[model samples]
Each structure stands twice: as C-alpha cells, then as structure tokens.
Target chain A: MVFTTAVNFIRARGPDELWRKRRIFKLAAHFIGRKRNCYSIAVRYVHRALVYATKGRKLKKLDMKDLWETRIIAGVNEHDIDYRTFRESLYRSDILLNRKVLADLAAWEPYTFKALTDVAKRRAIDDGLASINNEHKVDGIITRGALTKS
Target chain B: MSALKRVQQWATFARIWHIYDATWQNPFKSAEVVKKFLMGLYKPIYHPLNDCGDHVIIINSGEIALPGDEWKKRVYFHHTGYPGGASWTLAWELHTKDPTMILKKAIYNSMDGNLQRRHTMQRLHIFPDANVPKSLLDNVSNQIRQLRPVPTRLDRYTAEEVASYPKLIDYPKDYIIR
Candidate 1:
C-alpha cells in the first residue's frame, strides 16, 4: 500500500520537479546540452556568478589572492617554469613581485614573461633553491630513436 | 581555455583599459568610468531587461586617485528608511577606514534602481590587494590583446568658435532702461 502511494505521488509530480531543476540549471549553464551554441555566453555568466558570490565578503581577501596566484601559474606555464618553483625561488631570494602586476605582465606580454622567468630561474639557482636530481630518478621517456629526422 | 581563465583575462584587460582611458581623459574620473563600464552602459547590446554585462575586477582600490577636495567634501549617506534617520560618512574617513567602500559606492551609483540591479552588481570584483583567488585561473592565456581604441580629442577650434561668437543680448549693454 505504501509503495503504491509513493508511486502515485511521483507519477503526479515527478516530471514537474525534474523540469524545474533543469530550468534552474539551464539559466546559467549557457552553452550546455541544447544550448551548446551559446557556450561562450554560458561560460561567461558562470564565471561572473563565481566572482559575484565572493564580493563584499570579509574573507574575500584570502579568496582573491588565491585567484592572483592561479593567474601567475597560468602565465608562468608559457615560460616552462611551474608556479611552485618560481614562487619558492622568489620567496627564498627575497625578490618582490606582486601577483597583480605579475599577472598583468604575463598576460599582456609573454616574451617579456620568458625573460622574467629566466631571471627568476637564475636567481633560484643562485639562492640554492633549485631541485637536485637523485640517481633513482626515472629515465627519460622520449628517446632519440623515436624522433623523426628530416 | 577554461571559462574561469577567460573571465580573469577579461577582468585584467578591463582594468588596464580603464587605467589607460583615465590617463587620456582625467585620472580623477577613472573610478567613474570603471563603474560605468562594469554597468554595461557602453555595450551595444544593452537592454533594460537583460543583465548581459562583463565582469570587472578592481585591484588595489586603496591606491585610486580622487580630484581636488573631494576626499573632504564628499559624503556617503545611508538611511533606515525612516524620518530624520539618515547617517553620513565623510569621504576621507571612509577611505582610511575602508578604501574599498569608494569603489563599492561608485558601482552602486552605476546600477539601476530595480530588483535586477542587485543581481547584476554581483559581477564586480574588487580586491584591495594582490590576493585574488587561485581557482579563477584555470584557462588564462599569457596573450592579451589590448585592442582598445584611443578616444578622440575634442577640437580646440569648436570651443574657441563658440566662445568667439558675439554675446547677443536682447538689448545692447549701453541701452537705457527704466
């Protein structure tokens, strides 16, 4: 009897609930599913939603700095130096580069970024912050034999 | 590559665009321009019902510039929606207590006085320092295209011509009046 009642209730309201949830998600999902054509728009709205949620909050300071570090990492990626090593070196060498300017410099000009990265790497090495290799290190995966010679 | 990356890039570009624009115009007005740009007033597709707008990330709000005696004379007011219950904050005090308040006020002024305004205002990102979030950089590119066009300067002759025109009065300066 209970099972029958539950089935009847779901039959009467299940589709409505499902539709409502889908509609709510679709509002900001932008280009997902049938709206794949509007992917860029959807993506932008989602990004804005995240940014908005953190605004005016007292904890926003902690939140935004993380955002800066992430941008720095992405910018540093172009220079073949991961964010961790570069930042560690900066910290060790007492070199000061705020994340805001670093992110801007990285995005606006990648060539200058490469030069900066080279300088950072040199500084890191001088400060004895570079990682040292152990004999047990894994062998290189890409051998010369796999190369296609011209 | 990621949506987060794109938004951060857009925010950074928006900041640079605003700074350069301010330098060309008056640096004192940069805060006002930043507020307007974030409000979607300059977009071609702006519509009353739609909340289509760009996200604005404001960094170092503490370091923004103001013109003249604005820091002393400007007042921010808030009321409890009651008779004779208004509270006021002087600009200089607001700056020292919380510099971010100025940008927030500018943003609020730019928003429409409607229910949707609050929702749209959420897209403003104001950070007083370099501490932006880490999760926001998934797809940021090192390649930023600073494609903003320089605004045209007003012709000096146009203003001069307007001033040079004879001051036409209903009566001559020397005319006798009762």
Candidate 2:
C-alpha cells in the first residue's frame, strides 16, 4: 500500500482532488456568473478580486482623511473660525494637530475644541488673514486665545 | 412648530443675502462669488458634498454697468445638435432678451459642471430690480456689501453745485461765431 510513499497521491490533483485546487473553487463559490460555476473562470476572478482588495487598503486612508477634514470644518463654523482660518492659524501657531484628533475633540469635547479655535483665531488675527471674520462684536463669547493676546 | 418642522429647520442653516451689482463687473469673476455663495463657501459649514449653502437674492441687476468694450466683444454660443444649428449671440442681446440671463449664465458657467451645480443654482434668485417676494424678503438674515460704488449720477447734482461748476473759459456774448 505504501509502495510509492506520498508521491503516489501527487498525480490525483485535479478538480475532484480534495483539499487541493478544489479548495480554491470552494472559496470562489459565491462569485458572480461563470466566475462561480466554471473552474477556469473562477481562477481569473479570484485573482482580480484579491488585487482590488489590496488597492482598496490605500484608497480607504485618503477617503477617511477627507471625511475627517469635513467633520472638523463643520465643527469650526460653530466657534466662529472657518476651516481655512482654523487651518491657517494652526499652521502659524505650530499646533501640529492632525484633522482626525481635531475632529474628535470638536465632536466630543467641544469646549476643548473651542479653546483651540480661540487660539487659532488670535493667531490668524495677528497674521491679518483678511477673511478671518475679525468683526466678532456680536458673538460676545470671545475666543480665549484672543483674550490672552490682549 | 411640529417636530418635523423643527428638524427641517435644524437641518439647513439658510442665510439669505441681498447682493448688489451696481457697476457692471466682469461676469467671469463676479459669477464665481455667486457660485461660492450658492455652494455655501462663505460659511464655515460649507462642504463640497453637502447642500449647506444659503439663498442669494441678487438685486439691481438692471443697473449692472459694464466696463471696457466687453458689452460688444463678449458672445455666447450654442448648438441645436443638428446640421447648421450652431448660433452665436452677443452678451448685450442676451441681457436684453431676459434681464436675468446675463447674470444667470455667468453664475451657471462659473460653477463646476456636475449634478450638484443644479441644486446650487436653485438657491440663486436673481431679480432685475430691488423687487423681491415678501416671503423671501422677510427671510433675509443679512446684507452683503454691493460689488462696487456706481458713479454719481448727473441728476443727483444740486442746482448750486451745478451752477458753480468750474469753467475752462467764459464765452463772450458773440462767442457763437466760431
């Protein structure tokens, strides 16, 4: 029975061969159209699917970054600093805070975010960013950074 | 207000503007401002994907003044998608046909060519004069500054100022002979 040892089973590696190429067919069972039914078609689709899955890993990072910036911008409007002004102020003051952390603070810890906004407002005012909406006569709640500057 | 109404109001931060076009500005440049306003870029809440922009009520479009010879030079072209269906029209002619067309076209062209542009255009309400619907006028939250100061009109001159205007030369009684 063991005349050829493990080499005897090597010749039986076709579609019906258990725990071998058929395993790939099992994984590709849910694929669309001929990709699921035909063994030859399934091989090509499975390769293509894996390629797409790898590429999506990089794309997801950029998409999340854009989303975080948008959320941060939505928060900035409430505290009287527009997105451009807030970003500029952070750059000028060397805050080095990323948009993800900033968005978290804005949504969860609003007071902390407002404090940061006030800091940006003061720096932007000092830099004379023309569109910073410097006429804060109405809001009454002055940003803390501007208060510290005075 | 009902809960639904309250939710509706909270969803949109709609601010109405009263923009003026006294001196005719280059539509190419000024239309960008209109597009920005419609897209809510003036607000911190503005996101390219979101419909967070405000309504714009442009007034005094009838008095829009043109600079240089653009009135004669600028032309708008169109095609009917058939043989020999191409046509061209000057800016002034379009403006005459519909007082709002010039500003509307300017705003339309300045916006990005996409589906969202149509929604933004919907928020822009242009009028030939200061007349606006009562509902819209009542909702106006703020007034944006006019584009530029129009030159003082001759009719606005006082009698005394007109009579005292400096003269280069005083013509004699018989000065008409020349």
Candidate 3:
C-alpha cells in the first residue's frame, strides 16, 4: 500500500481495472462522452450500448427470413399456387430446399423454380393434396409408385 | 470466398417463423407461444444479439385470458418522479386501456434488458378486436397451431349437432333433471 509516484493513484484499482475502462472507452470512442475522461459515466452506457449491438445482430437474421419468405410467397403466387400448398408439396416431395434457396430460385431462376414446383405438384397430386390447380394432370397415374416397383 | 464459409453464413442467417393468435382460444398457454415468437427462439440461427426474430401478428388480443386471479391481482407499476408519483394499474385495467398492452408488456419483460429490444418490439402486431389493417393481414404467411382445441360456443352449435352431443345418464323418468 506504499506508493512513490502518481502511477499509484490510477494503478490502485489494479491493472485489470485500467484495461477494462480502456476497452469500454475504445468501444464508446465514436460516441460523445465515453471517449472523454468520464470513466464512470462511460462504463454504464457503453455496456448497455454493446448489448443493443448484439441484439440487433439477431434481429437482422429474423428480418432476413421474413423478407425471404415474402419473396418466395410473391414468386409462388405467380405460378397459380399459394405458398402453403407449394411449401407443403415441397416437403412431401422431399426436395429439401430451404427457404433461402427457394426464395432465390423464385426470384432469379424462374425455370428452376417451375421445375421444382412441377415436381412438388406431381407429388402433391400423388399425396392427394387439396387446394391446388392441375391435380387432374397427375391423378390416377402411379408413375412414381410404378417406378419404385420396377 | 470459400464455398464452405459462404454456406456457413447462409445457414447462420436465414430463417423466418410464423405465429397464430390462440389467445382467445387458450389464453394461458398462448402467452408462452407468443413469448417464444417474440424472442425468436424457434429458429436455429437465433442469437442473443441479433434481431432475427420474426414478426408476430397476434389477432384477438382483446379476448385473451389470464389464469387464476391474475386479471385482478397482477399490477403494473409506473412512476412520474414527482412526490408520491408511483402508480399501480391492475392487469385488467391495463387491458381495458389498451388491449395490446398485456401481450406487449409480457413480450417486453421477457426480452433481455437491452437497447435492441425496442426494435424487436416493433415487429409485434396485436389486433385487439381482430379488425387488423390489410397490410398486417398480408404479412401473416403462416400460423402457429394452438395447443388446445377452441371450444365451440352453444350459439354456434346446430340443432342436430346439439342433439347428437353426448348426454349424461338419462335421468330416470321419475327424477326431474335441472
């Protein structure tokens, strides 16, 4: 507890405290007061601000998913089908395309999406799915079932 | 850009969820579902810091239920910072004031204490009387299933259906059934 220099006053809290304050200051540097000599004030706001930054990252992902689903729905609507039937058909057919890929195909690759939709349509017909157009095309045709047997 | 890194990022960042309002059907159980949707915990890519939660449009919030005596006993506290500025409002009173407040407050308190939470709260859409705007109605792409079957009211039952409804032991002709 003996100190000969001014270093002791800042060092009294230990070297760890100094680095913690420095880290917070670095994070808050762009902001107003945290970058200044106000250590106590900076500590409280910086922690809260950092928490917000982290939470924002998660929120961004949720937003992206919503956007993707919407894009897919919009794209699907053009094909004379609702998103649910299209998606349920996709699931039943075991195409395994996630929302991101489905949305991309719906947006950029119309033919590819159409092909997938056709495949889903075929399976949907086989599964006796309700609420779809073109059920008549695949009805009473056991092509998939026949193929599996042969 | 390695393909593996690109795939990893895609897997980490892409997902949306859908929720249905079962509050009118089963109020107590529906709160947990609403909380999960608001928190964005249903997705594999969920992270504490990211605002990756999906938009939750809860219809029929005005008809939601509170189990036990919570509707009367549960109180929300606020302060104006004046001398004796503290005020407490019962849950039912708050619900009457703003039908959405119950769900909103439930979501708000469940979320982590952080600045980003307000942005997440913006995604919550509650319709008290189910007369929601068309824009919000369009946003509902899917529905979360209710935990319990919504019971049919007597008014909705047809004469045949009511007659067919299972009867308790036919009281003996001598005994008058109330």
Candidate 4:
C-alpha cells in the first residue's frame, strides 16, 4: 500500500496530473479492503489518500489564478506599461475587462492592447485628468475660449 | 491511441451493449429505489472503491415528480469555515443555479466522500433539459428514446389522499345493522 501510494504521488506530478491525483483510486482501495474485512490497513491508507486528493482539488483554483496573473504581467510588459500602473489606470478609467479576458488579449493580440491604451489616454484627456507639461500655452488657449464664449 | 482512449472506447461499447429502458403502468415508488436508480447506486458492479461505471444522463431533472412535500422540507447545509458562517441553501435555489447539482449533491452525500467515491461520481452526468447536446448524447444515442413512462408517482400517495380516506369509526351504524 505504501509503495502504491508513493508511485501514485510520483505519477501525479506528470502532465496528465489531474487524472493521477484523482480520488477514485483511494476510494476504491478503501472500499475493496473494507469489503474483504481483513484488509483494514488498506482501508486506512485509502482514507488518508482521499484527504490529500480533496486538498489538491481545492488548490487547483489558486494555481490557475497564479498562471493567469503571470500571463497578464507578461502581456502588460510587452505593451510598455508597468503591470500595477496599467491595472490602476484601467480601473481609474472604468475599463471593465476581467483578468481572464485581459490575459487572453495579451497573449493573442497586440494591436487590441495598443487600442485599449489609446482609449484610456483619450478618456484621460477628455476628462481633464491628464496633467499638462506646458501650463502657460494651455492656459492661454483656455482663456481665449472663455473670451470667445463671452 | 492512448491507454485512456482505448479504455474509454471499450467502456462506451460495453455501456451501449447493456442499456435498457422499462416501464410499469403502475409501480411502487420508494425513496430507496429512486435514490439508487438516480445515483446509479444499485448496479452489482457498483464499486465504492473505483469510478468504473457508465455515465448516467438524467433527462427532465426539473420535471422529476416528487412523492411528497420533500422539496420544501428537505434542506442542505454547508459551512464557509468561519464562526457563525454555517449557511443553509434550499434545494429549490440549488436547482436554479445548476439543476444537475441537486441530484449530484444527493449522490455525493450517499457515496460518502472518499477518494474512490469521487472518481465514480465524475462518470455520472445530469442535464436539466430534455434535449442534451449531440456531443453528450452521442454516447447514449443507442439507448435514447422518449421515456414517457406514464409519469410514475415518486411516492405512493399524496397527503390529501391519505387524509381523505374514511376511518372504520366514520362508517354509519345503521349501514352496519342492515
């Protein structure tokens, strides 16, 4: 039973790891042993294996989230925007793209990424949120517009 | 080509070979029998240790005719792992989010959460709609037929029926004398 458990753990590290880590085998081991009535030791081993299998399934979501963020950061770097700043800017501008969609776009499309960035910039300009480097020239234009309106 | 593929193909062939549908114009309905049938829990080959079984696709899950007020009275409970975090969601709510989950949860509870138990569970499939997609229906195509089995009662009699029956004492004394 110990040897089989060790083998299963090792096999679970392979590419088709999901199947290897699956709880079916542990359940079978316990059930078969229980039915035999004499193989109680195997039943205990199955119980332990089931606990580990369930734990692994719960961790799968966390692992998938980590993969998604890694992909997103890689994509963000390609577009010349620091990951944190770009994410903040997107939220500040009210872009509602989820991490899954963002990661997909980053990996599959570069032109779309640039267009998104450009829209964010345009929105900032229209909202009067972007800080102007030359205040005097923009101030003169603003004063001229106010005078024309009067 | 792969071992898994070969095994899957063989299992599919085997399942198709033994599939059957039967009907009784009037048959006894018991919770034990219904649970066993719905969960695929009755087969001789049922292994609590292994998930080696054919997939069961339950059609018209919503249309399941319950025996009594079991739908309203039965409650499911879960914990979020925080103090005072125990929550109870009604069976009806679970039916909407994923109707398949209602039956799946029942089966899961019956199987007792063990490693092998989880494996066999993945083989079971429940679709809320009568028309399951072609991809899923492909496996059971040989056995697929309109199972209009006379809408068999899930339980023996309704509460109203049980209440309406006259007692021996209710019989008229004059009728007995006659």
Candidate 5:
C-alpha cells in the first residue's frame, strides 16, 4: 500500500486492526460471553488476566517457601529438634543447603534427613545452643566452651 | 497398570495407624509432633489438597505434663452463644474435667484453621489412659516416639538402683533430716 503524502504514511498504522484485536481475542477465547467476542471488552479482561498471571508467578514462589518451611519444621520436630536449631547447626557446620533441598530431603530422603538432623543435634549440643528440654546427650562432641572449661 | 505396580501404589497411599505414648509428655509440644503425622506432613507425597493423613492413637493423655506453671496459668476459654455464657477453665481444671481435652485442643490449635482442620482431627484418637479399644490398637503398626524422655519419678525408681547411684557429695546427717 502506498501513501499519497508523508503525513498519510505516518498516520497509517503498520498492522491491520483485525490482527491487533485477534491477538487479544486469542487469549480471551476461554473467557465467557462478550469478553470473548468483543475486542474492547476482551482487551480489558486479557490485560487483567495478564496482570493476575504476573502477580500469581510471584505469589507461587512465596507460597512454595512457606510450604517448604512447614515441611522442614515438621521434619525437624519429628527428630525432636526445633527448626531454627537445625538450620543454625547446619550453617555452623558449613553444611550449606537451601530450604528447597532440605525440604526435599525431609520428604523423599527421610533417612538422609534424619542423619542430617542427628549431625545438627550433635552440633547444637556441643555449642550449648540446644533447647534445655531436649536433654539429648551426644557422645564424642566437644566444643570450645567445653575445652575451655576443662 | 501391572499387578505389582498396583500393589506398590496401594502401599504408597495406604493409611497407616500410628500409636503415640503421651505419658509425661508436654501436651502442647506433643501436639506439634502429632500434628505432622495426623496431617501426613512426614510423607513425601503430602499436599494440602491430598487425603494422605494417618490415624494417630494417643495413649496416656492423662499423664501429660505441663511446662512450669502452665497447669495453673494456661486458660482454656469457651463461650456459649447466649448472654454472659463465656467461661474460662484453667489447664489443670480442664485436664481434671476431661483428660483428653487439653491434648485435643493443643492438636486442634496447632494446625491452620481451615475446612480440613476438623476433618484431619477425625483421624486422631486421644485416650485419657492406655485403655484404647483393641480394635484400634490392632490397626497400629507404628509407634511415634515421644519428643522428650519420660522422667523416672523418685517413687518409680527401684530402691537398689537409687542406692547404687553415684553421688558427688553425701548430705550431712543433721542436714538430711528435712
């Protein structure tokens, strides 16, 4: 298509209006009633849906973190260790593991998780960071505090 | 699915009954541990939407220990939907009223308040004493370990064992009279 003047060429939209509306209509296909058929209405709902999708993506991560924390708490509690102590002990021992991996270990690899908790418990007891009520005695664990006392 | 695979699948999803001895255990602390089994959080296949919870039989709830002065300080509140029908019961009073009520409330409050809360609670059986029905006991193949070691009371210890116990220092004869 040729424009008669420079102004006419500038004013002409690059793509056909039909194609522009089709993009939005494609997304709104599953939507009900006028929102699916009408271009103006479809565009509004599509924009809103896209916004929700964007927000949901972030929310999904937060929700998963919460879930992993819950699972880790449950796993730690099973071995009579509090979640904070377990994580702290692991960190102090230089056994770096993220919550996702820890949660996975707690669920699918329970025995491995138990071993990890045992290590954590020993470390916690040695460091004197364990809860008083735990009262679990770990053999062969000596810390700076004990060495200085002796 | 193949026959062996079918059996494996059934085993994966099968509900297991677990027994927990709550004697000398802190009810509030035990509730946190019990909630996991009740909700099947220990299972790898656990999901909020999934029906993968297990049945938990809690025995000797009457023997549950309250930390510090909680037995007298902790209050359980209840209100009837009428004018001035509210009542607050202390932990000890509530325990005396119903041995299982404190533990039951602890487990109930431990979980998130949702539609599933009540349903999940249905799987928990709290017996005041170790008097659970044989039918329920027959179903239990696993025992949930207590969170803390049960203390041996002075009266519960054997006289010979107590006498043999090593002491750092002996009390003076005159000081020991009290």
Candidate 6:
C-alpha cells in the first residue's frame, strides 16, 4: 500500500499492532469473562500473568533449595550430625556434592547417605571441628593430620 | 495396562512393614531414624503431600539407653487445665510408668508437628519388649538397622569365652578378686 501524502503515512498505524494484540489475546484465552475476547481488559490481565510467571520461576528455585535443605537436615540428623557440620566436613574432605544431589541420595539411597555421614564424621574428627564430639570415634579413616601426628 | 505393569504399579504403592530393634539404643537418636521410615523420606517418590509412609514396629523399647543423665534431668510437663494442676514428671518416672512411653514420646516429638503427624504416628507400633503380636510380626518384611552397635556386657559373655580372652597383663598374685 502506498501513502498519498506525508500526513496519510504519518496517520497510518503499522500492521504490528494486530499481531501484538493477537499475542496478548492468545495468552488470555484461558482467562475467565470478557478478558479472553476484549483487547483492553485482556492485555492488562495478560501482562500481570506474565509478571507472575517471571517471579514464579525465581521462587521455584528458592522453594526447592529450602526443601533440599530440610531433607538434608533430616537425613544427617538421623546419623547424629547437624546439617552445617555435615556439609562443612564434606567440603573439607573434597567431597563437593551439592544440596540437590545430597538430598536425592539421602532419600532414594539411604545406605549411601549413611556412608556419606560416616565419612563426614571422620573428616570432622580429623579436622577437630568444634561441633563434633571428641568421644565419638570412627575407625578405618586415616587423615593427613593423623599421619603427620605419628 | 498390561498385567505386568499393573503388578508393578501395585508394588510401587504397596505399604511395607519394617521392624526396628531398640535395644541399648538412644531413644532420641533412634527416633530420627524411625521418623524417616514413618514419613517415607527414604522413598524416591516421597512428597510432603503424598501418603507414602510405611509401618514401623519398634521392639525392645524397654531397654532403650539414655545418654548422660537424661533419665533424671529430662522433665515432661503436663497440665490438667485447672488452676495449679500442672505437674512435671522425670524421664525415669515416666519410663517406670510405661516402658514404651519414653520411646513413643521421642518418636512423636521427632516428627514435625502437623496434621499429618497424628496419622503417621498411627502407623507406628511400639512394643516394650520383643513380644510383638504374631499378626503384626508376620507383616514385617524389612528390618531397620540400629544406629549404633549394642555392646555386650561382661555378664553376657560366657565363662569359657571370658577365660579365653587374651590379656595384656596378668593381675598380681596378691590382688584380691572382686
């Protein structure tokens, strides 16, 4: 289409408006009432929903982290170890397992989790971490400090 | 669904019965382990909303060990809801009143206080001794391992076994046998 004059061209809105409205309408299709068919109302709700969707993505990660922490705490507590000390001991021993995988091991593979706790306990003792009880002795673990002591 | 798939589905959702020996085990420590089974935290398909917990039968609760002076130091408080009706009971007193009360309370307190807690506690069956009913005993298909090894007392060793144990040094001939 050709514009007869500069004024006509200036007055003509681009075809992009139709596509934009169509996108918002499609998103509001599941919305109740006139929000699905009416452009003005649909756009408002659609924009709000998109904002919530964006925020929800971030919240999902935080919720999962909290859940994994709870699970790890529960798992380690069963072995008479607190979650902080367990993670610290594991980190010191060069076992860099993240919370997600650790939580999975704690739930799906209990024996493996128990073994991990034992390793963490041994490492804690070797490092003389303050939280650990000195009376609780774990055998068969020879650490760098132990070797150097003799 | 095929017959095999149907059976697999049933197996996946089946509630398993587990038995735990509480002999010589710290009640509080044992409670954490028991709570895992009760809440089905050990299952791969566990969810807070899912009803996937299993049955746990704890035996020999009468022999549970308390660390330090917990028996005398720990106090359980109760109120009758009337004026001056509050009372505190020592852990040993409570134990004497009910051999299973200490362990029962330990497990009950171990879980999060929620609406599901009472329902989950229903799945727990604690026996003061090893005399579980045959009906419940028959359903136990798994055993929850003790958190710590039960040490054998000197009296538990036979006379011959005690005599045969290698000694680093023999007692002086003049030393009186206690």
Q: What proportion of true contacts does candidate 4 retain?
A: 0.00
lDDT of 1 by residue, B45-162 (tens): 2334545445555555776556677779988888989999899989889879886778677767655578876765676666666455754332322222122434444564477776
The DockQ values of the predictions, listed in order, are: 0.02, 0.15, 0.04, 0.01, 0.20, 0.08
Question: In candidate 4 chain B, where is summed lDDT lowest over 10 consecutive residues?
Answer: B18-27
Report per-prediction Cα RMSD to one decimal: 22.5, 7.0, 12.2, 28.6, 6.9, 9.7
Ranking by TM-score: 5, 2, 6, 3, 4, 1
> What TM value does chain B of candidate 6 have?
0.92
Model 6 clash pairs are none
**How good is the docking of model 3, as DockQ?**
0.04
TM-score of chain B of each: 0.55, 0.78, 0.80, 0.55, 0.90, 0.92
Please give, for residues B1-178, the per-residue lDDT of candidate 2 as tens digits.
5555432324345555545453455555667666766777654344677677788888767656666777798898989999999999987887888878888888898877999988888888888877888887887766665556555689999999988999998889887864
The list of candidate 3 runs beyond 4 A from truth reads A1-150, B1-19, B25-29
Least lDDT summed over 10 consecutive residues: which range in candidate 5 chain B?
B1-10
What is each model's TM-score for chain A? 0.44, 0.70, 0.72, 0.51, 0.82, 0.82
* Model 3, span A32-124: residue lDDT tens: 743445888877778888899899999989888886776676566556566788889888777789889987776556556767766766666
lDDT of 4 by residue, B11-48 (tens): 31244311222232111132223334333333323333
- Backbone clash pairs for candidate 4 read A23-B115, A27-B49, A27-B116, A28-B49, B51-B120
Sorting all predicted structures by lDDT, with the top scorer first, yields 6, 5, 2, 3, 1, 4
- What local lDDT does model 1 show for residue B24? 22
Fnat measured on candidate 1: 0.00
What TM-score against the true fold does each predicted structure earn? Answer: 0.34, 0.62, 0.50, 0.34, 0.66, 0.60
Relative to the true structure, how large is the alpha-carbon lDDT of every model? 0.55, 0.73, 0.71, 0.51, 0.87, 0.87
Clashing residue pair totals per candidate (backbone < 3 A): 11, 1, 13, 5, 0, 0
lDDT of 1 by residue, A1-150 (tens): 234565577656545655645554566654445443354555566567667776747476765676567557656654556687777766665767787777666666544555567666655444445451121122222223223210
Best by lDDT: 6
lDDT of 3 by residue, B1-178 (tens): 4555433433334334455664555454565666666665554334456766777887878877677888999999999999999999999899889988887787677666788788878877777876878866775767877767667778999999988979987778899667
DockQ of 6: 0.08
